[model samples]
Target: MPSDKFDVLVIGAGLAGLRCARVLAAAGRDVQVWEAADEVGGRIRTRAIDGFLCDRGFQVLNPAYPELKRAIDISDLRLQPFGAGVAVRRQSGSAVWVHPLREPARVPSMLAHGGVRPAGVLALLRWSLPALRPRALKSSQRQDRSLREGLDRQGVRGELRRVIDQFLAGVVLDDTGATSNAFALLLARVFLLGVPALPSDGMRSLPRQLAAPLGDRIVLQRSALHVESDADGWQVHSPDGVVHATHVVVATDPAAAAALTDVATPPAHGVVTDWWATDQMPPGPAMLWIDSRTDKPGPVINTAVISAAAPTYAPRGHHLIAATALLAPTATPPPEDATRQHAADILGADGRSWTLLTRDVIPEALPAQLPPLRVRQSVRLAAGLWCCGDHRDTASIQGALVSGRRTGEAILRSPARI
Candidate 1:
């Protein structure tokens, strides 16, 4: 027996779920959103603690997402741009590749420091060109392979290999050997062309902005336990009540999505982010810092004095610094002291004066996107059941938003539903 009825019952209030419901409801279809958490935004959230804003992870928005412009207003986010290029920190020295453009002013400094090289400069530009080409997006008819193999084919070795692997490990949150070549190329295509921006309100605002118009349509703190298809449509079991609907959408994390659809879910990677507050800002352009040196302390990858990139993250007189390290499946993360030390070494900041904030460990942070990647997945799971999520598509914000939009459109396209 069911308590309420709707044309579509959406489970999970994450980016995908919200986007799906937004389309369905806009089309005059009866849509209801159920979220287990007290608030929406799922993995993309912002928390206010001690007068500081901490995002779920070090996240920036990509406006080049084909659907983003249609989904939400970019101006409302009040984006903050990252510096022209990233600062690569190595054991011997550090250098900025200046991804934005070559400047006459920077040439003298680069040459004087002896940090920039002709070979490395050539390698960076050479690989970036492929991202702009059409073939980068096309899936190969050949055998699937890892990013390491792809780099080898491009004749990338030594410094270039190490640099790409470390930078990408921060992006994919997985080791290079476990990452897919096709996926890596696609990522390169997305990033090389896209401008990264952080919302002034916070990362959570992106989803919150999406969920805003659907006032009464959303039900929070209602954990949907199971989904059972009936002769008529579908019954979603929840502790609050079972809702009957013609279409059921499961937009939860990989484990929950796997349980509902019986679809095999990919392995997830755990990431540890350590936060530190300091009145003293690190000296540098507002840019991301990555370790270009050999690994010494655990799997430290990148650190950002995020406040320098986006001032809204910190209080009026203070700043926020986040240091991220990827964890192996069965490996324990390094202690906070060691982690702070590692971050200081990479950031060239005084760790002793900084105060430690909370440390967050998201076990299922990102789904492992290995070889043979599909940019999109079929939304129609059954006659009345559907699915959409980062796991179904690319493990990314754009993929999640696109998947939700596709599911919504697919449902509307079904003749019986209309």
Candidate 2:
């Protein structure tokens, strides 16, 4: 027996769940969202302490996110674009500015020096060409190959692989060898289209805004323990009570989604850590720095300065530095002191100079860095059940939003539901 019923029941009040609820609610559907946590936003999290606004992980809003623009009011959030370009610092103690494509005339001359290499210039040309720019392909087709394979086939190597791999790791939070080349290229295309921005307040505001209009319709601290479907419709069991609805959406991470229903396969979970300081550090464009010289087991990618992305993130004169390392399921959490020491070593700072503000280890920060959509299925075994997450597309914020929107639209159009 169900405690309550609605036209649509959504699980996981993150960006995807909230977006689906917002769209269905607007269409006059009786919708309700269940969230395991006390608040919404899922991975897009923010925290304030001692006058510092720190995010769980370093996040940037892509100006070209199609569903984000349509689903949320970006103007209300007042996003601030990055200053100009990203400064890539190499292991050999050399650095270069990768200027945004919008200002091609400003390509830094220093990039042509022996220490600096132009790897993606040719691929950029191909993607920019009128004929090669537009092509239609299914996400599944794009996921059948790894990034390394695709790059080798396309003759992208040496210095180009370094640059692309660094950028891909930063965006997807995984190594290029572990990710899909087509998906990485699609991300690069997004940057070429427009600059990445951050909200005036913080990234968390995006999901909060999406969940706002739903009001009391959203249930918090209620994790959906299980979901079972039959001929009639779907039944979702939460800590609170069971809810019967015409359709069920599991928008949580792959692990949680798998636990709720037997239909989803659990994807790999990665870890990300953020450290905040209230003292001014280096001044430069927001960039991803990879220290190839480090002796760490896995590739350690760090972002030196993000204050430029959103100045309000830190106090007037402070800096926000973030570093992420993908961890295996059997790996143990690195000691806080070790993490701080690693940060200091990478940034060339004395470990004691910076105070650790906030640290979060989202064990499932990202799905396994596989080729795109290889493990994702549009339709699950359950008749009226659907799953949505970054794993379903390109492993990105945009992918999550787009997948959520498409799933919701698909459910609404299903004749079986009518």
CA lDDT, candidate 1, residue 412? 91
* Model 2 TM-score, all chains together: 0.87
Model 2 per-residue lDDT tens digits across residues 251-329: 8877787787765564665676757574757544455555544344233565555675677877787777766665557
Point out where model 1 deviates above 4 Å. Answer: 1-3, 101-116, 134-136, 141-144, 295-298, 416-418
Native-referenced Cα lDDT, model 1: 0.80
Model 2 residue 219 lDDT?
A: 85
Q: Name every residue pair that clashes in candidate 2.
A: 147-181
Candidate lDDT values, in order: 0.80, 0.68
Question: Across residues 1-418, which tens digit of lDDT does each residue of candidate 1 receive?
Answer: 2348778888899999999999998998888898999999989988887878888866778777767888999889998877756777866757775554424467557645636566665765665565665354555626557877777766676655777888788888986467877777777776666657789988998999999999988989998888898876988888877778889998888798888887678898888888889999887667778777765554577888888889998999899988888877787887888878888777777888888777878888998887776677787788889988888888888889988999999989875542
C-alpha TM-scores of all predictions:
0.93, 0.87
